[model samples]
Target chain A: MGDEVSSNQQEPEMSQLKPDPIGRTALAVEITNRLRQMILEGVMQPGEKINEKALTTQFGVSRTPLREALKVLAAEGLLELIPHRGAVITRQSEAEIAEVFHVLAALEGLAGELTAQVASDAELAQITAMTEELRQSYAQTDRPRYFRINQAIHQEILAASGNDTLVKSHELLAHRVQRARYQANLTPQRWRAAVEEHEAIAKALAARDAETTSRLMRDHLLQKLTSIRVKS
Target chain B: MGDEVSSNQQEPEMSQLKPDPIGRTALAVEITNRLRQMILEGVMQPGEKINEKALTTQFGVSRTPLREALKVLAAEGLLELIPHRGAVITRQSEAEIAEVFHVLAALEGLAGELTAQVASDAELAQITAMTEELRQSYAQTDRPRYFRINQAIHQEILAASGNDTLVKSHELLAHRVQRARYQANLTPQRWRAAVEEHEAIAKALAARDAETTSRLMRDHLLQKLTSIRVKS
Candidate 1:
């Protein structure tokens, strides 16, 4: 683990990641974001012990700021600080995954409801275009492209909701299970159904049917959970 | 009697107030909940400067844990940490109140739908009974009793959702606006309407009408927001 960080830089954009004179708190926050990205991208695997030494060197930071970053993540339930072993990525159990998804379903359902009511025409059109692009990516069998477009669809719904706190709360839970979400490999039948679900969401949202949009958003997430469960 | 703002040392009704803990972090968490309760109960007025000395004495803790507790509250947007001057409770703007209540409505709507689907017969019976009791409290013109039972009804619905994460997320937002929720001085007609809404919610939930239950829950909260806005 230590050798991995020492031998390879985690982010390609690390050259621009210089610690500022603004003090350790800001630096700690920067590291927290970088580390969170790492976790989301699966650069840091769950249950793996954190390589403090390598991160310190990679970020050109002292151990103090790096550890502070770890503490913040620990507080968010992303990392676990052990007595003797230092920080280990918290391995979420099945129950934890289900719990987070359940809340996320509700939050996304709210996003759908609000988006249906208030999304600008331009935003609705863009969401419709994104849904089309997601389908094309699926047709191309480009998983990474599909994943990016898929996430953009969800983010678009949240942004259209025009509720920052709700967006933030949804993002927090989404981050907790992001790795699982992106990694979910569905069977062909399930994949087709998932794409259809996204199309239905975009259509219902376009029709300004708040109830159908909300229900579709929720059921979409619950169906996605099955794929995540299959993958794990 | 005195010019002391937060000198209300809490009367007999709060018998479960004192929280002695074994560790600093636990003490800080306990103090956080205690402080949150104080804010909700209006013991600490929004925009009023915190009296550190008084809180330290009241909580029987040193400055360290109390300050830690204050920081947690600040992070939750319930308090603002000023430079040189101490903490001040965050005075929620009308916009902020509306935003929080909007999200709360969605969360409670989800709770209603889930409870309608999953609540035990005993739980629904209890909720129906609580609604009757709430009506009795109103009939007796006991505002305090009505307040307690009203909150209990909401709590019972959340409990019946069978999703702890949903409960916690809802609660985090609920605590943010609880003072507004409780302090809203409704007109007599509005109060009666509020009770009628609760009755409709209970009846819909009992009938397992998930969509109606969800919409009623959302509408009930939106109606409550009008009262809170009027109060402020």
Candidate 2:
């Protein structure tokens, strides 16, 4: 493995690299997405130093582009580039985690309020359907499926807000907060409460009750923050 | 002037450039600060292609660091890097501006609520002092001074919130939305109403009324949005 890594570290010409699969997307952007997914999914655990040699070999790219991708991720607050230590996935402190959740609650609440005002019937129907799906996942005790559905529902509402700036801002912080959230094992009572909160949120959306929807969304996120076991 | 411009354009080696006066700050970061100030002050107009060569000459730096600074600013949403066309200062559309203001209102509201809960006496006193200064500026019709003081008061509240993430997020959007705000000329009645709103906000802060303070802050921002004449 060491020999293979060393051989791959020999710099390859830029033209020899495979073309980006997504046309019009820059190579750095494509690399950034792949790295972001790895970090977000915990495949690359927080505080782990990114192995540039392995990553370059895995992606069949040169160091220049890979380093550039790291710079972009660092700028987005997903990674930290220490001068001599290279890049490490950032582990948010408990205080930082709480800070992120507080801001997210405000953003998601605003999204819910705006969606109520501007979402089309079709969009509202889609959110309602997702909520029902999430309910079924809960019933079946499929934690993974429930988590996916819950995220999708929140994302859909943000999209429905029809504000590009809000969506962008929310996604940036949400990406950082998700690692803590995924690790937080919700108790049975808290899980049930969350599901019921979703139900109320969907109902408010259906009724186009902007005030109630926003309030419910904000409170739901704040409640989730309490479930997180913050390390002292 | 042309001769002077040419003289400054004479290429200097990277090593020949002056060391950054801000100790330990990277060249790219210094460049980013200078560029951001230029764009914010309208020294570089919206949609104007960044003249890379001229900027390098002006900054007494090389193209590599200048381009890197442009990339950082682009990431901050203050500039747009068009493929092959070089970078241009971003011009927000009416919808985008409105969207940004809406999110800012939510973030600022959160700041007010949190600040009310946690602000130290000194912090509260500082805010109260800034409010008084702002009131005096309004009475004297010092629009520029009033704008500066208004921003300082808001900054104080965000600082008092004691949430780094909230302050970072609010400042990002606030920086982008400020150009539209500076151009908004408040009518006499609207100006007086704004001062009255600030008075109410100060009173709430003094009373430590979180709900009232949050609502007043949110409403104040939304009202300012109305004063902006969004171009069709």
Candidate 3:
């Protein structure tokens, strides 16, 4: 896993990569985002020890800032810092995975409830558009595209809630279990069910039914957990 | 706030303070915990710039590890690192406070549901005893003591949930709002209502009624938010 991540980074030098569009973001933030993406995308698999030397070489940075980024990710529960071994990608046990999904369901439910109350017509329309895109991905059986659009729709709901703390907390937890979620590709029946669930959630949001929207969102995420075959 | 925190630190010289028990924890973890305690206890006032010099002196550490700890706390939302300004204790707007409480309520609700399902008899007994102690503190009008006991009860509930991810997430959100929560002293009527609510939650947990327990626990925390007058 570490070697794959290292090889994938054989590209133009770090100086050649475009500077952050927002010049305000610090090096640590940029590095943290890159590492988090790699982990979530399974380029750095769960339970794999992070090769600090390789990462430093790949990013063309010293170990100091890279270590700082690892600390930040560790605090976010995406990495675990061992006493002597340094950092490793976090691996959730089956029970932990289930527990995370349960918590995510509640958080998403809160997002749906708040969004219904506060989302503007423009925001709702944006969500509707994302839903349409997700439907097309689903129809095309494009799993990766489906996943990306699905996340965007959920993220939009969180943003529409207008709760920065909620959004931040939700994003942290979402990132922790994202690899598992990415792997839990639905069976065809489950895929159909999920689409139906999304339809109901979108309808509730459109109608501004906070209670129904929250309930549907919560139930929808909870049902997603059932598709994961936790190893005994 | 700076003076108060400094005064609280007058007990011992940095060299005299005991070393970490395990001697294995990274300096960042130790520093993060100490700084987090200062912030959550309101010794370090919200938005106060963390005096890097003083903290480095107090902890007998170099700037490198201290800066790393600040980054970890920043990720945990207990501190914010501004561009060039360095790190300051986080300050949440009133809306952010309310949003945090709402998320806390949901997490606590899920805790109650899981605890009801799996908590050992001894764990439930521990919670009941904590409730009883909380009642005594309320009767004595010991607001600080009451607050401590109240937090302990909630912490115990989260612990009983047996979900590390849930507990970690809850603690992060709880610390972010700890100052506001500490300041939200209940009126006499609200105090009685809170005690009654805790009694109901305890009863439901004892009965192993997951649904009722979760609902009551969530409502109990949400009710606490009402006592807080958010600055408009």
lDDT of 1 by residue, A166-198 (tens): 887787789899887767776888878989999
Winner by lDDT between candidate 2 and candidate 1: 2
Select the stronger candidate by TM-score from 2 and 3: 3
lDDT of 3 by residue, B1-232 (tens): 2234233433332332333356577788888888888888877776567779988999999988898999999988888787666776666667778889999998999999999999999999999888898889989999889888888888898999988778988988888888888778688998889988888888899999999999998898888898887322
Q: If you assessed candidate 2 against the hidden native complex, which CAPRI class would it receive? A: incorrect
**Residue A47, model 2: Cα distance from true site in angstroms:** 3.0
Error of 2 at B191 (Å): 1.6
Task: Report clash pairs, candidate 2.
Answer: none
User: By DockQ thresholds, what CAPRI class is model 3?
Assistant: acceptable
**Better structure of 1 and 3 per TM-score:** 3
TM-score of each: 0.78, 0.86, 0.87
* lDDT string, candidate 1, B2-32, tens digits: 2131143233443423333434345656787
lDDT of 3 by residue, A56-169 (tens): 999988888898999999988888787666777766667778888888998998899999999998999888888888889989999889888888899999999988778988
Worst 10 residues of 1 chain B by lDDT: B1-10
Q: Which consecutive 10 residues in model 3 chain A have the weakest lDDT in total?
A: A8-17
